[model samples]
Target: MLNYKTLLFSLGIAVALFSCKNQETEKKTETKRPNIVFMMSDDHAYQAISAYNDKLINTPNIDRLAQEGALFNNASVTNSICAPSRAVILTGKHSHLNGKIDNLSKFDTTNVTFPQILQDAGYQTAMFGKLHFGNNPKGFDEFKILPGQGSYYNPRFITKDGDTVIDGYVTDIITDLTIHWLEKERDKEKPFLLMYLHKAPHRAWLPAERHYKEFTKKEFPLPETLFDDYTRIHPEDLEASSPDAASKKYNLDQPKSRKSTAAKTAEMNILTHMVLTNDNKLKDSTVKKLGIKERYLGDPTNRMSKEQKAAWDKVYDPINKEFEEKYPEMDDKDLMKWKYQRYMQDYLGTIASVDENVGRVLDYLDDNNLSENTIVVYTSDQGFYLGEHGWFDKRFMYEESFRTPLLIKWPNRIEAGITKEEMVQNLDFAQTFLDAAGVNAPDEMQGESLLPLLKGEKDAWDRDAVYYHYYEYPAEHAVKRHYGIATKEYKIMHFYYDVDEWELYDRKNDPQELHNVFYDPDYAEVREMMIKKLEETRKKYKDSEELDKQFIKVYNDK
Candidate 1:
């Protein structure tokens, strides 16, 4: 009905309107997202980090994370094991819900993850280092992960297309690969989510050549319970004249006693932190000689090149010679002490490299002008026992292993130099990442978004406590199945596998968790209250004896 001139004019107005709408949508998308770098280390203990406790060792690089932003004073893991912790972080769900309660359980990648949410929301995602999940990772634009436990020296990494062995330390190599992706492969147009993981400071601690000799001579002060004789040593045995030399030699008593059947079964101790050929940097011949007495444990020299072995020999041969001369004559208690020192040295040495590499990543973000908009986080899978209770591994509900170091820096949104004492779990990680990208987390996700807490909304929300469950029973370390709830004031736990026992600790009076007052008459009222809370928490998480019974067959197979 209209003339040709009128029709052309109408078409022109419609084109202009559509362009403006599209531009606004693009701007909105850009404004909502922030780049994220999640830097995690395997088995790095909170006590070992200088930021949490400065008495043990210096960690200037990790301390920078705490200094620059918020440090979580009460960060914890639901499950203290490796792969289970990672699974909880990814899915924002508990172990039972996520179906990865223990290392033996597979991480079902089909479940929705925060990375998938971000990826769908137009964020470019990259993961480097130990993904730990056996299968190839999903929801990432690109990934290069270590195979199995991955090696310490010249580790092999599995990439999208294929696998290649990179010649360098694992921590250093991970950082190198991360920077490479940031510099070359990343899409400049999209915001990124990069998960940088480290394999050092895990089991069979192995340090790189640079840090091999570090902390070798320094004898770290032992934990008060490093020689916890379990009160088996009577007062008479403590006498100087006693024939029980081990009991008399190190006369010490735990402040308050809270013995459990599980504690009696614990097998992971500093003495159990055995040195190996590659772990101790010993020559194959030296390890064999130590094995003659059937005292030395673990496998032979790890896979390494001739040049690599020679370099290791240069550093450790002298130490091995000294140890070989002294160890046989030493008493059992003294031998345990010596082994503890060796374990700590190598463990701390590996951490030194991790810290140095952390500095590299921090530098990268700062140098590239990414610091302003990017969120930087440093944490570990869970806490490890640094000779606490004479132990070296994690998986205890004890504070030494329950608490982990968490430092997060978001320059634009979060103020620097803040510490939050609220109890936050790794389960909250997925929701937080989703919140950062302005993406809504699914209702199925169990963890509440930690964004409010991290943003200094101290009173914005209230979660009175956190729940924990561990189920790798009849497995390694002989740690029984346990579940508990930790409020700010108290922690109540029940170890139900192989034995039934309850342990309750008053956090204020005994922060070290040295004693359990589960049966004390003074705590009768509190016990009732905590038990009710524990029941509620269990119900909230959908974890109970019935659930375990349903899944018991799975773990039983092994």
Candidate 2:
């Protein structure tokens, strides 16, 4: 009986010790900070993303995030430009507050970014690929960034040691560098924040040889508003103002809308600006023979080596030869059709490389057993115009340029296949990240934490509107300075500086934004309410007319 009791006591002690060990493991798991993989591509249109719309191209890898995670339908940027958009994401503040309102302006180094905060909280931060503006980004223990609009092939990266050129396609090189850092340099004991940025599908789109061959042959459907002249003023459109008075004052025979002025003044028309030699890769001799003036003389061949040039010529020469034979006999409309095809081919080809690289990174996480404890985010700097309004660039408050694609996946934390309709901006990224890591966001950061929405707490999210402002006017593309408020139901904009115009649109009624109803008597109450809302939003964000004028003066001095 004594021997049996001793045996029982030994077993009980063993059970207690095992239970204590299990509890300690659970505590460690609970305390571990999730790793972050924030991926951003330059000028990647939401429409181009297959998850949002499969009409343009099929991006299986990027779409995988949306399938398994949360896809934000109303994700947008505070400013629809490159540097400013990135600044907003980093500082969790607007362009004005960050002091990077335009690409020309220098980034205010004093502002504390999310990475800096994360680094302070014992996180290992590393950034690779296109930082776009800054040579040395803050808070990152290691970074390899493109100087400025780095080349698509054999690009130079600015590292902590010094500048070095990597020999390969940029998209592939960036992915390789990121993976190398993860597999070799990463500390297994610490959580990490990794930023992977891409410069693909930006202006002067250059793709890898494999993608160039395939996408060039695949023709894409044109956007519905490809030929939009921006001049049509329907009878109902005129009813907003006194029709008789408007007709007499503005000449009804050729009615012009506000879009007409905005569109015509802007230089983004692809047909005129997208040169065949510079953009479409037609031979200079062929272009000369066709009596076409090439838009710019920036030939990618100048940067290519003998072998790289040979490879490029092997693919583009045949396509250019076919164009030379056909374009001579084609009319303006037919030429527009051809140019649109070429544009889609080169642009989408680069995106193909990006999609493939994204898959590689995701697979790295899955193979290494990091998916469950890592948060992967895929987004673009800003949305781009892909043949919409006959345009090809971004920098407007229009839907095509404003609404960026945002997808996030945090296994076991965020439910799969969730589609969020609430408006979220790049501005929310910093706070959202800090909240997820259990770190305190700086009080000066203007954006709200997106934790509630990311965790599928719809009732906890309460943003009714978003504010936007663009300051780079009298510059490239000539997009006028504008500020606006966008809600689920309406959008009100004031185009100031060179042009003083106020436009409002009922987002539900005019989904395409084909009409401006600011003066419509039928929408008088809505207009008043929206105006009040805009004022309140501006006040809340701390933007004012005085700042607008100050920025304009700063711009003028330049």
- Alpha-carbon runs more than 4 Å astray in model 2: 240-259
Per-residue accuracy of model 1 over 299-375 as CA lDDT, tens digit each = 43366678877876777778889878986787878867877877888899889999998998899889998888898
The TM-score of candidate 2 is 0.95
Q: For residues 157-183, write the lDDT of model 2, one tens digit per residue.
A: 999999998888999999999999999
Question: Estimated TM-score per prediction?
Answer: 0.88, 0.95
User: lDDT: which candidate is best?
Assistant: 2
lDDT on C-alpha atoms for all candidate structures: 0.81, 0.88
Model 2: worst 10 consecutive residues (lDDT sum): 246-255
Best by TM-score: 2
In model 1, state the lDDT of residue 515. 63
